[model samples]
Target chain A: MKIRHRDSDSGKIQLEMTPMIDIVFQLLVFFIMTFKVVAVEGDFNIKMPRMSAGGAPSDQLIPPLRVRLTTPQDPNAPVCGIYFGQRQLASFEDLRNEVAATVGGGGPNADADEYEVELDCDFDLPYRFVIDAITAVSGYRDPSSGQIVPLVRKIKFAPPRQASGG
Target chain B: MRYKKADNELLEADLTPMIDMTFQLIAFFMLIINFTEAEQDQRIQLPKSELARPPEQPFEVALTIQLMKDSKTDQELIIYGGEVMPLANLQRVLAREREYLTRTKRSPADATIIIRADGRAKTGVVQQIIETCQEVGFEQFALRAQQEEAG
Candidate 1:
């Protein structure tokens, strides 16, 4: 007995394009409405000050470098005074130089566990200034690759001080 | 000499080009859409920083906190999940998050917190939020900032 391999009524199998087109249009509308074009975002990783858990004594050799940020007497002053240890910095450039020097110009000493930069800012100081201070001390821009090669990996905040009389 | 009537029924619109254009639009939108916006608050203007760089790897999971301040009063408004909550309530939410992590057998140290604060927001307020997170045992933090425009 010969078996019929094909359908008795042979015709072009039509695909309903209307439903598929409708769904695709729906998806296009959804995406268009929800789309947002934003610049790439980045982060400055910070470790929140935590109480010591009494681990083994650190083998750090270098002492922590301190930075102090003080607001001006005038409430509306745009710039704040930045200090590296006991010496006052003339500008953010000066702060960077001081940090580079303290961290040994991002040399081998910069890799030491004890090499830390602690930021001490008055409570009234704007956060933008503090961020500038962080950026200044965080690293030096490598001229060759134009990348920020981190100088001091360890950073912490000194307990914020109350704003004094302005 | 009689003329034959011509068929006008074959003039249907060609939907193939329309479908192609729609698909192209869909592809463009799909490529540009940022799903992360769900976790970000448009109200917060991130501070720009020269040292800030994009994370090497995206965190598998993170809790986003948005901090805003009243321009006139300087009072902080903490936003979580699109709702404004007091700082005390935020701590409670953190506690609940910690509990959820514990139940999931994940350590708080493994959890990450992202703080998106307005550029003008006070540093002290941001620090307080960080300290609060620290108090709850979260060790990793990502302070979001916009990349400084190069001159």
Candidate 2:
């Protein structure tokens, strides 16, 4: 009897995996490049004052007015701030006048458009200061438009940290 | 005349390289992933305001106070930031930190008192922390809370 080897069984299996490997490594590199391990410090747990009443109805994006409260030049003290817009306003009255002028110039339906004035205050600042700031912003109205935008309504308060407490 | 026939035609896929690359990619994501808690494990949510902007300069180290219910006993107050210090001492420590920052001319503004109060933690305790932060020279603060859920 003669011993015979099977030629088909003897051949090595060759799989074309170069492209697959390339993709795998590419994905690896991509993830490595984009991966960020942020050491987020601080405990994020508190009941933030409810901001949205029903969520600003789907249609409204208006210019925002800003009111920032700074630590009185003295760090050991309470907070105070300067209220001014691009147009220099000497007093609270001037701020109101500028707002009225701006709104009046905007023409029809400008009043219907939402006007948001945001108050920026430190967490440490007495809530009273924030309330007071809200009051000031509320007093400004465009008599021509008969629009009375609330002072602090539709407000967004952010944490001083890069990320919000949430 | 007659012709001879071929014995075999074989094809196989090599998976060695592909498997190696997949392992490497998985490793990369494993190393660089940042895991922020999706929900407040402690059930607290933070407020958002537009006025909140990043500090001009990175803040220097200061005492931080974390208020959590004791994980073990559930009765004691667990205050851990740098060390476990009593809330009463918080004001004194902050005032001292303020003077030191001022003496160093580093701007007391750079030091912040991070208050991490559990959602259930009484508002009174949070108020106390606020009072201390105000009494001390520290003006900068970051209130931490879970983000609200998307509706």
Candidate 3:
């Protein structure tokens, strides 16, 4: 004997929403789990000249400005001393001011082309200190526009110095 | 007792609202996701700098090197192409990269080397890496740093 339903509604079609919702939720969860918010990263472009065994000595007119970074013997000390040539700088601000002065007062026609800053850092000095010194000597803020103008485009790294006994 | 049946009614839940919410979530995730995360190593904490500026133009060919300190040995380890290696191995890798670039008719000067060193890492280690890169004929260098807010 054949059995038939009395209330058969086979002609109407319905889309299954459960599975679709399940997949969508899964995708949302995946994306949310993988999402990472990171701080903006940038780069300071530099040109590293090829190292040569020997080169002829030339008569150079201007000497590169040297910035020496000395770290305390105590590893726990967070402060590092910044020096501009023979003069010790009180802070990064002082170093920046001294750099600006040496670069002819940050004028429009200031001869930044002839300026080069040599960063001589101790072997134990943290990388943060080197970048801080670079920031101090590399550029200056424009008082009028509040924009950072490049002062010394060229930067050279001197041989790392051994940390002296404090 | 006999019961009389009422009219049959089909119940449905609207899926439009659910789909709209999912799409909104997808958009938010897409905006925050970083495709360049592979180039960045979470083990390395980048130094913060106010002078760090975004590149004027993206380099067509760039190599990223991540430097981090080994917690166990307290020695600097260089991570290149997701492989952690010592300085000698890194130098060899750079040499190979330079050779590959030369074979592909690309100038070593055109290829940019981006160094991402930890903030607390010694400056001398980074300097040595630069010196190694220079020895391998890489002229263009980019020091990666996080952009710090100016006071």
Ten residues in sequence with the least summed lDDT for candidate 2 chain A: A44-53
Q: Can you write out model 1's per-residue Cα lDDT over B1-151, one digit (the tens) per residue?
A: 9999998655757799999999999998988778776567777777788778888998866888888876777777899878888787788899899999999999777877888888677777777777788888887888788788654
In candidate 1, stretches whose alpha carbon ends up further than 4 angstroms from where it belongs are A1-19, A52-60, A72-78, A107-114, A163-166, B1-7
Taking the candidates in order, what DockQ does each have? Answer: 0.62, 0.08, 0.67
Q: Against the true structure, whose TM-score is highest?
A: 3
Clash tally, candidates in order: 0, 13, 0
lDDT of 1 by residue, A91-143 (tens): 88788888787667876456634487778888767677777777787786777
Candidate with best lDDT: 3
- Decoy 3 TM-score against native: 0.86
Q: How many steric clashes does model 2 contain?
A: 13
DockQ of predicted model 1: 0.62
- Chain A accuracy of model 1 expressed as TM-score: 0.74
**Segments in model 3 whose C-alpha atoms lie over 4 Å from true places:** A1-13, A52-61, A74-78, A142-144, A162-166, B1-10
TM-score of chain A of 3: 0.78
lDDT of 2 by residue, A3-103 (tens): 88678876577667678677777777777776654433322112222222113332337745665654345533333554544343344445545554555
Summarize candidate 3's per-residue lDDT along A22-70 as a digit string, tens digits. 8888888988888777888888777656642112222334787889888
lDDT string, candidate 3, B1-151, tens digits: 9999876886666879879989899888877788777788888888888878888889989999888987688788999998889988888999899889999999778999999999788888888888788878887888899988776
Select the stronger candidate by DockQ from 1 and 2.
1
Which 10-residue window in model 3 chain B sums to the lowest lDDT?
B6-15
